[model samples]
Target: MSKILIVGAHGQTARIVIDRIISETDDSLVLFLRNSSRLNEYDNNSRVELIDGDVLNTDSLVSAMKNVDIVYSNVGGTDLAKQTASILEAMTKSNKKRLIFISSLGAYHEVPGKFGEWNEQAIAAYLPGFRESAKLIENSNTEYTMIRPAWMSNKDEIDYETTQKGEPFKGTEVSRKSIADFVMELLSDPTQHIDESIGLNKPNTDGDKPEWI
Candidate 1:
């Protein structure tokens, strides 16, 4: 069983992915989060281990990378660039290669049309951080798959499609379950989409903006 490490284990989609990982695969998991106690229910799960640590701390990140075959970063914040640097530095120090990074739409200005403009205005504050994180990951030596999910929703379904880095992003929102399902697929085949940035959204979700907004 491959050992996978999940940074930012408290994220909503990450939680779905975690539950699926336990139920569907035999892989062992190391869950790292700032507040590990938030998931205290997993304490006795044999295939899971929890660590409370900061993603910005390279030393702590390197320690967590030990014996970890794959790393999934579900973190996002205003300091995402710094966090990405720390993750990359620790990966280099630990001699680990495979990583799955969760970025956001518009990080590369790949979102198109009126919807794109709307999204830009909606998340302008966080765009710089996402862009910087994308830059660092794209320039890194690690085998990385960066996922840029569209505006998120809590819908209870998994129906999504992808666009490559240079392709125009489709749709305005996607269910978090869809993103988790895609991440689960990547976990099953680490070699798929290596060093690629993918845009994910529910098929047929195209619009100027999400329906709710």
Candidate 2:
């Protein structure tokens, strides 16, 4: 069984991934979060190892990464690059190679139409850092898959499609569950799409702007 380490385990997307992992597989999970108190529900899960660690602290990250085979990061914030850089450094030091990262659609300026324009303007400061993090992963020697997902919703659906780096990002919004499903697939089969940066969106969502916006 694969020993998967999920950074930013308290995140909404990561929570869904954790639930799926618990239900669907016998793989072990290292759930890393800044606050261990946030994971009260997982206290009884034997397969889930809850650890408190800051992504910005290399020593903390290195400690959290011990015996981990794959690292799936669901981190997001204005300081995205710094966090990712730390994770990469720790991964390198620990000799852990496989990585799956979650990024934003606007990070690559891939969002299209009016929605894309709005997204760029909305998260102007944050997008650049995400882009930088993507670059950091792309330039690394680690086997990685960087996922850039469009505007996310809490909608209950798992229907989504993907576009590679150069392609125009399709649709306007994708559900968090859809993103979780995709991530789970990648974690289940790490060899697939080893070095690709993919843009994800719900199929048939073409519009001038996202429906929710």
Off by over 4 Å in 1: none
Q: Candidate 1 — which pairs collide?
A: none
Q: Candidate 2 has what TM-score? A: 0.97
Off by over 4 Å in 2: none
Per-residue alpha-carbon lDDT of candidate 1 for residues 1-213, written as tens digits (9 for 90 to 100): 799999999999999999999999999999999989999999999989999999999999999999999999999988999999999999999999999999999999999999999889999889999999999998999999999999899998889999999899998889999999999999999999999999999989899999899
